[model samples]
Target: MIKQTQKINFGKRSGLEVYPVSMGAMRFPEMDKAIPLIRQAIDAGMVYIDTSRGYGDSEIKLGKALKDGYREKVILSTKCSPWVFKAEDTDDSSADCTYKRILESMRRLDVEYLDFYQVWNINSPENYEKATCKGGMVDGIRRAVDEGLVGHIGFTTHDEPENISRYIDEADWCEVILLTYNIFNQKYKDVVAKAHEKGIGTIIMNPACGGMLAENSPVIADAVKSAVGISDAVEAGHRYLKSDPNVDTIICGITKPEDIESTIANFKKPAFDAAQISAIEKAMNKLSPDNAKVCTSCKYCMPCPAGIDIPAMMDVVFHDKVLKVPGIAKEKYDWLTGENNKNASKKPSECTACKECEAKCTQNIPIAAEMAYLARREEQSWK
Candidate 1:
């Protein structure tokens, strides 16, 4: 049985102590599978549970799992997207409208009050303005807090680091902030530190870069092994985030019992010291010139006119060449282009070099050229 280690105060302002690793219900399995996993996590000391209205039926599944006295043991959180509501209809951000949505979430989760309520996906300056404007979603959540229907209020974001920092500075009422940060992308390092310095809780989402870091990579494995003497990339990724003192907690999207077990086990292991972490960082930084050119799989450049999955193809190229893991890349390529896969789009060879996707790329990647190269590689090596 996994034992709960000493808990830490989540933030100076939140007044809630929690375990370092939390459970995210975004990928919760079916009810029978979810109930055991939820109980196991809480029983093993992962007491902070986060869900969102955007995650289909997650709130309902979590609600059912929280029954039988499981509700009292967690710091429950859920988010609402004001932008999604606005897209559906105006006045969705009004205090009454937002409150009704909050109540509906509570009803689904079978909770009297939520521990934390976040305005979801405040990804740009315009989103920030809309959320904080008079009678906005933030105002509506504040009204809920005033009536004791919710506790602390915060926001989740996928915005740039500068914008996130600006939001942190301006949103004094925000007690917590959730954002994506991982070993592959430390762009938010300063933002995490700034939030911590200001007594705002920092929750890290996608610590593994949406399973990219979790995949086998000889380069990553060697770096981690040299630094910490452990070679599991996923464990190394989680450890890197855990070592950041400014990060209050990491939310792992658990889908099965074994996932919870592995997460708890990783948490129980010791974190890398400063020297070790520096060594790992230095090793990763020493990659070839192509390292800077690697795709992050953010999928900003998508929807090819020819229907090619530019990100997946780019990922295959990265793993095969940059990471020196051709086997994994081959497996992914076969799966993506296999005849049996009905959802398979155009193969890399089908790319027409229209350069449409290149225009939308955030990283300024040469999408057409990369696709052509991948197509050549598929012909020469992948069969």
Candidate 2:
């Protein structure tokens, strides 16, 4: 069982105390249909709210919703697009004009100071140069700290694990690190441990693996061995990080109150038996190096009103996981529905914005919104 809350104290010598759980507002306005959801998260003791300029209008509404003294109660962190760090307007090479961008993010956030201001998407060597150059991004971050415009300088990355490990080793100035992490995508396995050892706060991103695991709840359960495994499935994931002791927080993207409840419940009893962890490993191996679908494929989400078999959709999605491929799944999707006569069924267009499917979706995919987008974009002639 989880013996404690998920939050941990971060040191950059920065006195930042936050909930072990953070709300990533990347899907802000989209999920912002109900402002109460945001309120619910904060009310639940989620003190960390992460946002980025890349996520259009997310930070804006986040700023708006965080009114009524909400700002003082929480730790607000946001990132600047890498484009801002570039000197030329047209060119967006890896080198960052970090010094200038932090100032802008401050203006955009309408804050005198930010708890953390990261160089958004600084995931490659080119990005490394931009941020850490002699007169690069780090200089600006340091200046911001001196100027009292930002508290600490952090960076988020999606680079290959080994390479990122090297960068972390070299850039001793980094106080916090954000990266893609989850059961399905455990690329930074060791580096995360290493970062914590270095006293750098490890903030996990993509913990849900893009809603892939939410779909496969029964599979997730069945895959776990009763003995010798981690604790609960949710805690299983948390335990993976929490065990490291270096991880400061897990920044999960949550759009509803239920997600917050579920996440907190896991924290309540975070435990992982050796056997359960092994089961998950076996399941991952079965997923294979190739032709693997990370989602557990549990039909927790049922009754999609469009008769859009959710599991079946994932089945195909798993197979055609290669985004570059215009696979049979797309073909099937088109055949099932569209303006042209096919199965006398609904196309993505047939979806109404009632969002009934969203509430039922274990993964909580914004189906109605997605369907509308897919339906409206059929002009390429899918004949």
Winning model by lDDT: 1
- Please report the TM-score between candidate 1 and the true structure: 0.82
lDDT of each: 0.83, 0.64
- Please provide, for model 2 over 10-71, each residue's C-alpha lDDT reduced to its tens digit, 9 standing for 90 to 100: 75445566667778887653534536667678778777888876666676666666778777
Candidate 1 least-lDDT 10 residues:
84-93
Best by TM-score, which number?
1
TM-score of each: 0.82, 0.69
Evaluate residue 298 in candidate 2 and report its C-alpha lDDT on the 0 to 100 scale: 61
- In lDDT terms, how accurate is model 1? 0.83
- lDDT of the structure predicted as candidate 2: 0.64
Model 1, 1-383: lDDT tens digits are: 77568788787879888888888888888888888888888898889888987788899888988889999989999988766433235436566777878988999898999999999889899989888999888899999999999999888898999999899889988999999887767778999999999888889898876665666777778877887788897888888887889988889889876777787788777888998788766666655334556777777777778988888888788767787667677878888889957678588888888898888887888888888887887888854
Q: In model 1, state the lDDT of residue 238.
A: 83
- Backbone clashes per model, in order? 0, 25
The C-alpha stretches of model 2 lying farther than 4 A from their native spots are 1-6, 11-13, 30-34, 83-99, 217-221, 225-236, 290-383
